[model samples]
Target: MSDQGNPDPTTMATDPTPSTTGPSARRRSLFKANGVPRSPREARASRIALDARERKRKREQLIMGKRFRSHFEDYEESDSEAEHEATPTEIQEINRGLAGSDEQVAKALKLLSARLVSPSAALEKFILAGECVPHLMRLIHSPNPEIQLQATWCLTNIAAGSEALCHKVLDAVPYLIQSLNPLNPDLADQAGWCLGNIAAEGPAFREHLVANGVVTPLVDLLTTSPNSQLTQTACFALSNLARNPGAPMQQLFDAGICGRLVKHLSQHESQDVASEVFWVLTYLTAGELQYAHRLVEQDVIPHLVAQLDKFADQGSAAIPLIRTLGNLSAIDDATTSRLLDHPEIIQQLLYWVAKSPARTVKKESLWVLSNITAGTKAHVNKVLKQDGAAVLTEVMSHDSYDLRREVSLGKREKLTGKMIRWVL
Candidate 1:
């Protein structure tokens, strides 16, 4: 139908040799390598598919972010609530967590010890409210060492401040006394701490503690485990029970607590232990004067005198022994004479009175001398000849006129030649 109609017919009729199939197939292979589907249906459908690794990573990040936000919000809420809602119920919840059987509570106890606000206050409230007594009792039996320790600590704090709590603690005394036998040092220490606090509140709960044979366990502990603090606390508890100063004193006297205590005091191991034992002796002697005489008859004075030669360091235990000696000397003539004649003790006392900078020890020295010489002319002369009067007169410079007049008159009344002549 064109000007070259004859030629067009010829070109149309020719098929033109099949185009090389290699390039088309190579193009298809390239598309497949790039993940472009060759099929129409596959290309039209979803082309991007997520792999397991990428999906898992996204999930983990999401979870981590959620956890972080949750904790952050919780911390903020806790802070805000602590300001206004630190009520009894809220406090109890926190205390329960602090004493929980979980490892979290164990961490909390350690954290609380280092914190400004003691978690123990909340614990005390729980105990006083009567809500957690059974829980606490059960917690004492927890398999976790830290939970048991914290529970014991909470009980100690509670018993220390509340009468009701002390009664509750009385119910648990047998259990605590049993815990004393635990082979662990820290556990035994905790038990000792609990008993100490209960005992410290005085003897209102004495019969409950003693009727259950509590002393035997504590005394038994001294034989095997001699933790200074534990032993000190035990001695203090025993002294509190014996505060009545009566025939019941024979109970402790019979247990031979005095001998053991003296033995501990005489040894220069730990100053704290020695100081506590010294204080216990002071309390025991002050209550019943015979106990002071009993100590002398048992040869405790010589050992005490022997300790005088061991000069105490900065926080010397010798000070306590000196004070106890002063008290015992005032209680009995036998102790007075024995102490006055102990050369080591006399020289140390004089030096401490005259030279030591501690006004307390210095004052105790003067007072000890006065107590020893109070009723006996021989003791008075011994002190006077030993230059005790000169030093005592010096103490007058530090005293009021009333005290000076008392000392001056006391010197005249006690320094008689008749008794001095007998001794010389």
Candidate 2:
């Protein structure tokens, strides 16, 4: 029985092939009875509907195009807006923060000391430049070593690189030097870094320091300070003193800084200290071959050779160590030849050339190899016969033109024309 709730109108109609008469055809027929459009009118209405849709789409495209252009041109304005947004509302705030009194400066110095490694570079710049040295000096007496340390670093950075700041820094030197004796590593490092900066500005300040007997305290620090940073900085300062072509160089020699530096070189655990010691020696021995024999006599070559391998594991040390060696080799031909004779050095270098991935180490290795082989045909033959030509040739092709010329000239003097031609 058919359910009365269910419409049986289609079943009663007895239409055959119900599946063939699709709903679309039926709806079209029903539309004709409902006063809808005829065939021609229906086609016209469809065209109108399609035209409306296309117009809507074009309007949307125009809106989107306008949006894109606005976005593109607004970049500069937006950037300016962002910059304005970041114009540091904190300047007036910092000034206000710093204004109250001596106690306020102390509090700011303490707060700044905590912010030394802050994510804010602005805060660091402000702390370094804006604070009065006197204020920092007051905080230096605070029971906190960190506050003293930060105050020292801020002063060093402010004074180190600027000649205009030298007098200002010199004014602060007594306090800074006093801070050097503090048992804190941070304070010691800042003091040493400041000294290096002063010496780096050239012979003027260096002579000033030496003439004032500052080198004695600095050298004594190198000897007694267990702090690596301080010792290294002291050595760097001494190097600058020795680097002076004036009376300060003689002063360093007289002060016995050279011997102390050599002793510092062998004993330090810090490669940085070792590297600077070598540099100090380099500066001392530079142009004057008189010290070359002394350096060799003191057996500096073996220690340098031992440190050559140290560069393999620590790549940053490689360039400085290699440069130091090159400078030493440039001191005199005999010392250069003596350093070349160390079997372990040559082997370690050759091994690095073969295995080390560091481009700097490889370049340094090539240079050290070239320096060792220079002025000695026997050594060149030993290197070339050991199949070092390919590496040397590669270095010649890849290095700077000046270096390439030096290498080529040095190689030519060592290898026979036939051997040189064969390599080239």
Candidate 3:
């Protein structure tokens, strides 16, 4: 007479526990009144529904446990709204606004950009997980310039996070590349900065950037943009693009970046711009000797020699110049001769070898001289004529093992037995 003895059919069908009657009774209860068994599709559907419900229950329990633990933990919440990570509900609202009317999209982007400006890794991860990247990528092509700019600003911050997060934003790259037009210098600058961050991830990302046609526009900005900031950003992006050893130097050469960089070295008064340009050259020359030869054809050797003399005491500026020179000198006799064409090149090398306090600079300068000495006998004479033997002897006695090793390997290998004896 009790409800347990006459359980509701709905409850019986849904419950996992068997009735006291038996397994056969429970199985019979699952069939229709006509005593036909449920079809295979119906059985499958029932099992799927049961699994979904079980999963949902478990997920809810886990979330509740996490919330309870967070509540009891010794955590101090920041008062700043920007410091706070967005909840799923809040992120969902943001996503809706992003896909909404023009006014809604603008408001959402402004809010997103403001939050990203502070560089919070947690916030970036939250936004990325919230599925905002695809929407941001869509907005990058928005006709509204302001909206496009704000969206790009958000993406730049996102890409500035870890390399894993940066990879998520790869789909936006082509759109970012298209944004690098001089007509929109501000947007172009932001886009270039974003591309630089993306390219900095690794060689694969750099290759993607190049394959997306970033070089030509970046070269245009570097050569002709009236905006100094834009030009500098372009240089930065290009430097990152060319940083890896396997970079497409031939493509960059065909784009005429080498010639433009040489002209900038001679004419640009901005030391920062010149430094960035120098880095691009260093990376490019790090490729095949043909690329270094291309730089030599640009008459880059004379400009580099002059710059090295002027900035010798400033290691930040001088190292790249020395490295570029070293890369050029390593090419062949013709290239080394072109470098030595300037009488002061050897003197500069000896000055650094004996006096420069930075071991790296000393090593690089020694590397240049070593390359020269390794050349024909005339090259060795050029080094010796500059009192190279005394500098080499001083380095041999120096405290740094690296400097001593460089001298031993470079001078001992190619120098005449007389010079080697003097150095050792």
Best by TM-score: 3
Instruction: Arrange candidates, best lDDT first.
Output: 3, 1, 2
lDDT of 1 by residue, 1-424 (tens): 0100000101111001122221100111123444445576654332222124323433442221100000001122111211111235555455666556487565444332222112245545655674566666777788877677766665664564456666777777887888777366666756765665565454566666677766777666555665664665555455445544221466667677777877786664865565556656655666677776787777777777766655343323455567677777777666678777776666778777667766556655656665766657667767767776666666576765544443454443465654333222
lDDT assessment of candidate 1: 0.53
Query: Scored by CA lDDT, what does every candidate get?
Result: 0.53, 0.52, 0.66
Would you give me the overall lDDT of model 3?
A: 0.66
Q: Candidate 3: which stretches are off by over 4 Å?
A: 1-121, 142-147
Stretch of 10 with least lDDT, candidate 2? 1-10
Query: What local lDDT score does residue 236 receive in model 2, on the 0 to 100 scale?
Result: 57
Error of 2 at 255 (Å): 3.3
Each prediction's total of clashing residue pairs, residues at least 3 apart in sequence or on different chains, is 0, 0, 0
Taking all chains together, each candidate's TM-score versus the true structure is 0.67, 0.64, 0.70
lDDT tens digits, residues 1-424, model 3? 0000000100111011112331111111233544343677765554456447544533442221100000011222211112123444545567788999989998776556544433345556666675688888888888987788878877876675566678888999888988899888888977887787687667798888888888888888877787766776777677667765447677787888988888887887766666667667777787777777778888887777657656767653466667777888888888888778887988888888887887767888888877888787788888888788888987787647877777766654556887677656
**Model 3: which ten-residue window has the lowest total lDDT?**
1-10
- Name model 2 segments beyond 4 Å from true: 1-103, 110-131, 137-147, 182-185, 239-247, 351-356, 396-403, 412-415, 422-424
